[model samples]
Structures are given as structure tokens and as C-alpha cells.
Target: MKAGRKVWSVLMLTLIIAVIAAGCGGGNGKNTGGNAQPGNSAGTTKTSTKDNKDVVIAVNANFITLDPHNASDTNSISGARTMYEGLLGFDENMGLSPALATEYKISDDGLTYTFTLREGVKFHDGTDFNSEAVAINIARIQDEKNNLRLRKSFAKVAKVETPDAKTVVFTLTEPYNAFLNKVAMAGMISPKALEEKGENIVKEPVGTGAFKFKEWVQGDRLVVVKNEEYWQVGVPKVDSVTFRPVPENGSRIAMLKTSEADFIYPMPTEQVSEVEGVEGIKINKVDSTIVRYVTLNTTKKPYDDLKVRQAINYAINKEAYIKVVKSGLGKKLDSTMSSKTQHYSQQNGYDFDLEKAKSLLAEAGYPNGFEAEIWGENDSETIKGMQFISQQLAQVGIKVEVKSMEGGTLSDMINSAKTPEEAKIQMWYVSWSPSSGDADGATRGLFSSEMWPPAGANTAYYKNENVDKWIAEANKSIDPKVAKDIYANIQKTIWEDAPWAFMGVDQIVSGSRDYLNGVKVYPDGSINIRQAEVK
Candidate 1:
């Protein structure tokens, strides 16, 4: 029964690109197609992704949920986007873009934000798109009882008023530079569906996007059909969009080559060479905001000790992580946030040192490494990453058992723990991108004590009095300089605290058949299919 709880309630919850010479497929992810590799590198004979009526996306993991607010992971957020619309949205570059809202203005005083609604738009369920609909959506996220992961993003909202059918205004208690980005992340749900479906809306979602949910079989495939009533005219170019989860690298690669999948994300950097000379497949690489790390649960045993946490960071070889795990396609993470992120500030230390790691482990009362379990998604790369980490940690006398699961099941395990004492994760090998594209989005949800699982994604259960104060100060600052300084302190403190084993930032690589067009992966590593069509 607990597992049946809506993900909306639970899951609210990079790199250098130095290997560009080795041909990883380039796209700075700044603009849609700029700097990308040619559609067909080989320019050989093959069936074009052209002239097809439907498109299939093969992803490395399963979607966690369809509920926009509760869609915690990028895959879930990507799936939700097919059926959802927000007052504001992020462009391919992660810049703020108007979605349901036609235009907006912020008061010079920095507390009030006013938006004009897009008219003549109807949700997939036929509900009118208006100020009230936006109000209803924000209200759900603001409610603490619902435990929405999006709550923190909207925490500053002091008031929301619909001045007219087309106008909605928000008054925040304090200034938050990231507010607009947060607003963009809140995919607007249909008021009619929310009232009717209630919690069931997680499975039966309704929205105002180019496509509508047709079927979701879970762990297999999810389908969406063109929304005839979609506000954007001449869109939904494909008759249907199917998302298949093929976790195995070999199988996913085979699917794309055999025409079973038109596109596959995480194109398995190790296999990029296999598809490069292929006839119908194209490889796309981009500098991204994604960071990979092993979350060391501070509330759990062997990790509660600060020295233990630091040792884990010291033990992992960040260089090998890029060279071996990422196939020399990424940069070693230099800070809590990717260097590509706004307000990013670098912190020193955490370089690979086996002797130092062993010493730290001994100092932490673990002269003979203690046994622990590490968790990750059941995908070839992730399992490989985990194995790599396990082997590296082994050198420091830390023996770990690796565990992997589907995205949905992983989300459930992390969120089911209502409190830190009930949490089970000792270490989690995971990757994160602040989909909202802000420093607060990167820091708060993962490091703030207030965000501990079920409320937000602070799965490490890390907390600090000074760090918390700095986070609040940073959020409330109106000047960029002041916010920048505060964020610097937050990063410096977190880096020393070592709640995570800083790994590497990704050089995002994805592949699609030469015939596929318009589907793109944003800098935040989110899949965008709004304009997906055959070549």
C-alpha cells in the first residue's frame, strides 16, 4: 500500500568534453542544433528516420511518474512534458520561456511577479487555460500536506491572486533569483483532472501540451498520441510517440540499429564508436549541467562519521571515473554544482589518494573496512559505474555490495522512508542535474535538512547550521554579487563536509536514427520531443 502512494507525493524529487577529438558527438546543449554532429556521420545507404508517422525514444531507465509536480527524475519530467504545460517553461538552453503564460513582469522591488495567460488554449481534458488553472496548480505544490517535491521551489510564495481570467500575480515573501526557473519546472496540471482524478492523476494525467497520454504499461513502454486540440497549431507532427526503457546497453544499441528505437539517450559512450560509422544513426554530444556522485547517507552507519564520508570521496579516482566509467568523455567534478551552472564556485581537495583514504578510514574507527551496500539504477553504465566505485573503495578496505533497481522502484525506496531514522540507503551511486537550471535547485533539494526524502531529495540527510543559514541568505538576496558570495560559502562548506563522493560531470551523449528530427536533449539532460518528427 505504501508503494502505491503517488509519486507526486514521493518523488518530487557536466563535463569538459576534452574527448571531442575522439568524436563523442557535439552540441553545447546551449542551442538546439548548434555544434552537433552531422545527422549521418557515415553518409552511407540507410532508411532515413524520414517519412515515419511515429517516433520511439529508447531511454536508459523507466519513468518514475506522470504527475508533473511529483515527477522527480529527468525521465519522469520528460514524460510529463509530453502532456503538461507550465505558466513558464525552459527553452532548449534552459532559459525561461513563456508556456501557458504569454508574458510576465517582475516588480522592481523584487517580490511580485505578474503573468498574462495564453488565451484560446485548452487542456487535453478540455479544461479552459486561465489564471485560476495556474492558481490551482501552484496551490497543490504549496500545500505541505501533499509533501510535493516542488514545495521548496514555491516556499517563498506569500500570495497568489487571479486579477482577471487572463492574469495571475504572485507575491513572494523574499527575492529569489531562481523563482522564474522554479515556476518553469512546475508543469501546470488541468484543474478539472486534479479535482476529478485526485491522487489517481499520477497515472491518469491530463495537460495542455502537444500530445496526450494514450497508454502506460510501466517498465516496458509508455505511449502518447497527438493532441488534436493542442494550442500549438501544425504541431504534434508524429501520430504517436512511444518511450521504451531498454536498460541494457547492447539491447538498446541493437534496438536503434534495427529500427525498433529511433533514438536512444545515454548512447553509451563506450559504444559511441560502434554507431559512429553506421548508416542511419547520428551521435550528439553536449556539455551539460549533470554531475555524478555517490550520496553517502549521513544519517546511516559507517557514514555518520565525517571522516568516513571524506574517505569515500578520497577513495574514488575521479580521473578513472571519466577515463574508464565515462570513456574519457567528462570532467572530474570540481564543486557541488557543475562549472557549467550559474553561480558555480570551485572548491579544492578530493583528489584521488588511496593511502589518504585508507588513513582516513582508519582514523574513523574502521581499520578493517566495514561492509555496506551501494544502490543505483539497473542500467549497464550505472551498474558499471557502481562496480567501478566498489572496486575503488575496496582498496581502502571498504567492501560494498552493489544493488540496482528500476527508476520507479528506486524512487519508492528513497521516498518511503518518512524520516531519517527510517531511511535505508547507505550509499547511492546517482547522477543529478538541476532541471530548473539554478544554484538553489542544485543545492537546496540535495543538501538542506528540510529536504530529506518524502519532502524533497536530500537523500543523504545532510544538515548544518551555518550551511542552512547561508542557503536561506542566498535565496533571499536581491543582488547577484551577494547571492554569489553566499553560494560560494555553501559550496565550500559542503565540499569539506563531504556528504557525497564527488564523481564527474557528464559530456551528454545521445544517438538517433538519421531520419529522426527535432528531438533534443537540453543542457540539463532532459529529453525534448515537443517538435519530434521524421526527417
Candidate 2:
């Protein structure tokens, strides 16, 4: 019998900135710990002093790395809160807004991008913003040793040239329609700083952001002081920003409840209502691109069979999983592409049916059900979610052994599971978010055959000639609509194959005291610290 297909795919087909001061010469500062009163509409924090008192911004995880060219994790991106600047930033409405580049123009050929630097911008270490700085920063990212995180996205750039002191031009080997959006990454560091710090600089960042880096004690806290000399006058109202790494969900919420911290970004969903009931605490919820999904090792056993893959997809009850695991903070996913994204197709991917799954299992010669290993990050929610799936799969005779480990370790296990001999785990839970709006932003790193196990991020070992062909054609297509349609097809095709059992999209929650102001959250989960203020 031909299976009823969802519109989504399931087949076996394939596919900134300037300088100001010279050194770390600033005033003495004190850390005032407690609940901060809300700031006025101007986005300021009342408890913060205009002078030397530092405002702290706490996080659950420490940064993975600070190199804009090399870092890929959210922690590293979030670390940009105080350390880097990009040419464009997301505004309160989640639209693109200017940052370092005052104005930019694309050549008639659409093969070159020219950016005119805004005057008076300076690096935290006091280097002037000019053509030389721009030239060097681009070159550093192009350098192979740096292993910049998003390097493949820039493979089309022919060269970076500075025509004048304030003007920089990026000549592309081929016209890249997504180039502008790709440059929205906050990891763009200053060339001067890179030359000075070499490989050691990420630990000590210097950028033209609202806050200035002061000190980072690994696994504990990263502190930043106010940038009084910041170009945008009256901006970054807070005296300073600090990121404290407290991994436990309960403790992180407790820190906010006890007034130990002024603001807690992304409060655990399970603890949301409890925190909201507390007076003086506000829970701001918004839709986001952060998604948690299960990636099957397509090249490995059990999963290699399309029916088995489909069986796995049909066996689990996603609605129940979301209700319990997400704790009311998720939206079901219909495709690998985020629902919040513009190009997403509304077609459904999979709907739960245990009987059909069992029949598919019997057809695949697993009538008795087979045993498989599943992996997820050690986080409380992730482990619990996987355990739930284990129980659901058991109803169909598939025994799932759940393994929990740190994210880095889990990543290693998935990466190493490429070859049949080396395959240890058959399935794993993974989450992803696009660095920017472009389709290339999500697919280039995760789907490309270029990224093999251990070396690149292709964890599923998923590859298809058709997907690759579509990607290549889309890359060459200059027309935005044409490219979008092709990528949309790619999303549909990927969904049909079931390489990943689409899971859920998460909501990014920010819990701030009434006093802290200027906190705007992006669907991508990035915070615009520059636009925030402390009263």
C-alpha cells in the first residue's frame, strides 16, 4: 500500500567598527547585587548608578569562543552582548537596522558590495574605523587556520578591497544574493585586535559595542563596563553588563526570584508560571527560531531503511511530547526550516499513528521491534524528553536505550557515527536555529556534503544528489524569488525523507525585573544590548 504522504517530503531522495581609547583605563566599579527597579520608557535601570556601578546580565552557559569567524554555538553568539559589532542589527520590530556601516550600495552587476563606514567610530582599544580595519577583518576570516565558523557562506567573495580610508568594497567571485544578510553575524572582530591578540584574543575581546569588556573568569562570570564614549549618545543606559553562567534551570530561576540577579534571559519554561506569580518579576514571551528535533543517522542501520525511519516518525506522539517536554513553550515543527521564517511552506511533515508505524516495522522485517540507542544533551529537559520518546517507541516493540551527556560530548558522538563500523548511536536529539534569515544560513552548515563527520557539522551524515543539486543551483540564482522557491522545495524534500523527525520550535523567554529597561528579544534569541538602557 502506498503510504499517505504529507505535503512535506519523506522520500529516499537526496539533497564593524571603530576605535576610541588606547588601553583599559576606566574608573573603579562595584557590583550591586539585588532586584533592580524598572527603568523609564527610555530603557534605563533605576538601581544602577550613572557612574561606577556595574549592571550584571546573567546567562546559563559560558561562551564557547569569542572569535566571530570561528564560533558556532549560541553561547558564543550571546557573548556578543558586550564584545562585538556588526554592520546591521535587528531592531525592536525584528527588522534589519544599521550598525557599523552607515550606508551601503550594491554594484549594478550585483557582484560587489561597498560599505561606507560611519565616521567617529572607534574600537574599544581606541583604533580608528577605516578601510584598513575592514580589509584586515575580512582577510582574517578568509584565513584557513582561523577556521571561521561561517566560512563556507563567504566562499563566493573574490576579495576585500579598501578604495579609501572610509570605504570598503567586497568583490564577489560570484554574485551572492544572501551576502548582506550573512554579514549580520556579531562575531565580526576588528583587524587591529586580531593582529594583537593572535589566537589568544577571544578571551579578551575589544569591540565598538554599547558595553566594554573588563574581565572573564572562565565558567564563572564575564564582566563588562559601560562605554561612556559610545558613538550613539544616550544609548546603553546601564552602567555595565555582566554574564554569569549558572547552568541549573531551578537555580537560575531562584536567582531571579531571590533578587540575586536583576534579569534572567530565557527562564526555563517549566518554571515560568512560578516566576510570573512573584511580584516585581515580568515574563516576556515571544516566538523564536530555536527548534529542538531528532536527527536520525540516515547511513546507519534500522534508520537506513526508509520504512523504519517512517516508523520511528509515526510511533512517537509529538503533541504529548510538546505538552510535557516543552512545558507550554513550543510550537510543532512542519519542516526543518523554522516556521517563523519567511520562506517556510505550510505543508505538514508527520502526524502520529502507532498502528501504521507497527505495520511499517513489520514490513521492514522488524516485526518484533528492534533495539536502538538514543542520545540527547544532559540538560534536564532534553534527557526527560528522550526518555519519553523511549517509552512511546516501546509501545511499538522498539526498545530505546537513552544516553545523556554534555552537549559537546553528544556532538562528538553524532559526528563520529559516520562509518558503519564507528556508528555507536542510531538516533539523537538535536536543535538548530539560523544565524540569519537566509536559507544558506541554515543549510550551508548543516546539510552540505562538504561538512563530513568530525570535521564539519553534518551530524546526520545526510546527503542526496538532488538536494546538493538544488543547493548549487540556488546559490547561482541571483533572483531572490527564484532562489527562495528552490530552497522551499529543498525543505519539502528533506521533510519527506524523514532524516530528522521534526520536533518543536521553542519560545525565547526573558525574565526581567520591572526596573531593568531596554530589553528587546529577537525571534533568533539575540539580545540588542546596545539599544537597552539602565535608568
Candidate 3:
């Protein structure tokens, strides 16, 4: 196991100009319709009946894509995990574990990785899972023409060799300490399916996981059925899983209470108290590596000025945000990466000070703050956070118009931008979890200039030559001390640059029926249901 086991953890516009001009305010600050208290049975665990064999999970948003190699969002990653299996995977503790690959070893020089893949594994489409299958997946991601979202993670991969059916070897151009973690994150796809679907792979994902794709209704729900021939025996106890996108917090709570949903993610911190005493319902909370922040489009005016970015950061009260927006259930974010993330180093904290913010604004040549718009998903909590941001920035003379739209629409708007100049975004209230369980996962996608939109998650258009250099160095460093130092420098420099308004760290709160067993939420907010069972 020592092979690589060293490290462990939008917008929409329109209906007329009037609606756009009039900012959309936050919803009434109260849980209303979903307030029906659970019955006495809520407090006790119920035995799973035959009808309960199929589990229903309600999420805050829809999945963006099922293609594991191209997924960047948490919801999408969770969905892809249901059907895809990587050579390596993270254990419950977020440590590296063998998945499709039974064993692996790294060369002393750290330039070569040899893997022993598990035998008899088969893709959902019945394709044999062997060394060739692993090679095909790696080649797909490493292919420059594909422009896969996770291509950079495999950038150092120089060559791949499959000596036999059950063995695959990867040769790196240079030492990469994070390569194992990246492999774990890059789930394998069926070569046959890739050939058949090609670009449509995102819609038709085929893999060797516990569950096989059943159906996907965009914007509404995604359903997956258990794989009877799953490589791992006696697992995937549930017959099926249906993930419904319920953006409304109250509606999700209601579904949980009524047993319409066996589980729901993001138990909406504001309503945690409401379900605390409910019978037959359990609320699970864990510290997460997720960080909520506002990506300030650095290429845009006002935000283009470093002083303005810093001023915005100083203006907002992060503690108040945790209290009001998160209902005091989260931690104020101090750095670009969450403290739970690997190689995380606390940077100089930005305390709320209106005077300093105003002064900085004045120095940035805007004594009177300018007008701008902030965009976020239509989720209740997201809009509330954006509203709070709008109000806080207003105090610093920055007039903000808040616009919340469906998640898919917002994604289209952001990703469609071909360049920084074409990006219409000014500020985007968003959250990110480096589910890959590495410092590079947390930093590279958001900070590295090479990861700009359409290619990676760097939506802010933030660029820094020094930070980029350090990011690459940190990933390639085999020495922990060197990597840690480089990461610390990266965080410190980004913190000072203020490309983002660090908001808070998430408390991964999920609610499930007491009878739902073995379903655990990881620190990255992705749920593990491979061993989940009812009763």
C-alpha cells in the first residue's frame, strides 16, 4: 500500500429590463411550508421495507456531467462516481486505496508508476477491465485534442505501457508527488463506450462501478441502478438510487420528513434545528474541505485593480457571513484552500473594517464605490449569501445587483466565454471542494493561469506568474517539506492578491433516514453509497 499511500487529505436574465434593474432580494428568512414536524417514528430507526430498497437522494443542484475525467463540480463528481471506477480511490479517511488497481508501486526516482489491476472486473457495457482498458482511459485524458478538464493532472505523464492484461505502467516525465491522488480522481471509462460515444461520453458514461447508469433527466433527476455484476462482491446493497435536484431548501426538508427522499445533502444549515429532534431522521455533519468564496473577475474593471479586490475582501464581514448565511454552522475561510485540505497553510486574515475598505476604494480611484452585479445559482442558501454580499458591499459604496438563476444556465454562461474579454461575469458567489484530496487539486484548478475557463475551473481569470510557478513546483516536488513550503507561498501570495473574497468553510451536513445505513459523506461533500443499505 506504500506505493503512493503517503498523503491523506449564474445568471440569467430577463423577462424585461425592469426585472434585471430591480435586484432579486433574498427569500423570507424563515422555513415555512416544510415545517411539519416528523412523527414519533422519526426519532427511531425503522427497518427497511421491500419498497425502500431503492434509495432517493435529494440534492441542491443538478449534476453537470457524468464523464468522470471531465467533471469539476461536486454534484457531477458524485454522479460519475456511481458509474466510474478509478485505478485508485480514497478510503473513508481520505487515504489512497486500491480500487480497480489491486496494487501499485512507484520507482525510487518517482518517475515511474506500475499498477496491478484487479482481475475479472467488467465495465457496465460488458467490456473487459484490464490493462488495455486502463491504458485507453489514460490516453483519453492525456490526449491534447480532448482537452479534458483534468488533463493538467496528467500533464507530466510521458508514456503508458501495458505489459499484460492485469498490469499497467505509467512513466512520468518528472517526479510528481500528487500523481497517485490524480489517478484516483480520474475515474476509468470503458474504451468501447468511448469509441462509440466519442464526444457524447459526457451524456452516456460507461464504467465499472457499483452502479450502472439507468437514466438521466436533465435539470430534474438522475437515476442509477445497482450493478448486479459489480466487481466488488456483496456491495451496492441498494437496488437503485435516484438523485433529484431540489434547489428549494424547504422542499428538500419536506421530502426528508415525509420519507419521499431517503437522504438529502446540504441539510440546509438554517434548518438543522428543525430536524434535530425529528424521529427516524438523522442529520449527519462533518467538517469539509469545501470553501465558499466569490471569484472576482480580475479581467473586469474595478475588480481589475488589486486595491479594489482587497477592499472588497476587507469590507465584507466573514464572521457575520458564517452566522447569518450559514446559520453559525461553518468556519470563516482564512485562505484560498480550506484548513482541512492537504498542505493548507493559513495566510494573513482579512478582518472586516469599513474604514479601511473605504480608504482602499478611494485609493483605487473610486471614492464612491462603483456599481456591479453578482451572480449565483438559484439555490435558497446561495441567493441568501449573494444578498448578504450585495448588502455588505453597498456599505462600502459598491452598489451590487444580485441575480440568481438555474445552475445549468449559469454554468453555460460561465463556460461559454472563450476568453477573459468575452466573460460577462463580474463577481460570482460559488463554492469548491477539492475532492481529489491533494493541495494541487485545491489550488491548481482555481489559481493556475493555465486552468482558465472552458479548460479548468479558473473562472476568475486570475493570473500570477509567481503563483503559477509555485503551483507546478509544489505538485512536482517529491519532498513533503518542499511541497509544503511552495504551497504556503502560493496561498500567501493569492491571499494578498485578493482574487477571491474568502467566505467560509462548509460543514457537510446531510440528512438521511435512520434506516439508511453505511452512507457516509466525505469531507469533500461527495457521498459514498457503495456499501449503503437499508435497515
Q: Which candidate is the best by lDDT?
A: 3
Off by over 4 Å in 1: 1-50
For TM-score, the strongest prediction is 3
213-331: candidate 2 lDDT, tens digit per residue: 88877766777777877888887777767777655555555556545666776676766765564556778888887777787878788888889988888887677667666766887
By descending lDDT, how would the candidates be arranged?
3, 1, 2
Stretches > 4 Å off in candidate 2: 1-53, 92-94, 411-425, 453-455
User: How accurate locally is residue 238 in candidate 3, as Cα lDDT from 0 to 100?
Assistant: 89
List, residue by residue over 1-535, the lDDT tens digit for candidate 1: 4444333222211122233322223222221111122233333437554556788888888888898998779899899988898888888878888889999999998999999999999988887989998889999999989978788789999999999999999999989888988989898888999989999899988999999999998878889999998887889788899888777766666666666778889887877875676777788998999999999999888899999998889887788679767888899999999998889999889887666788888898998889999999977789878877877787678898989997778888988999999999999999999999999989998888888888887888999989989989898888999999999999999999999999999999999988888999998889988898785
Q: Could you report the Cα RMSD, in angstroms, for every candidate shown?
A: 9.5, 9.9, 8.4
Query: So what's the TM-score on candidate 2?
Result: 0.86
Estimate the lDDT of model 2: 0.69
Following a full C-alpha superposition, what root-mean-square deviation does model 3 have from the true structure? 8.4
Q: How does each model score on lDDT? A: 0.84, 0.69, 0.84
Report the error of model 1 at residue 112, Å.
0.8
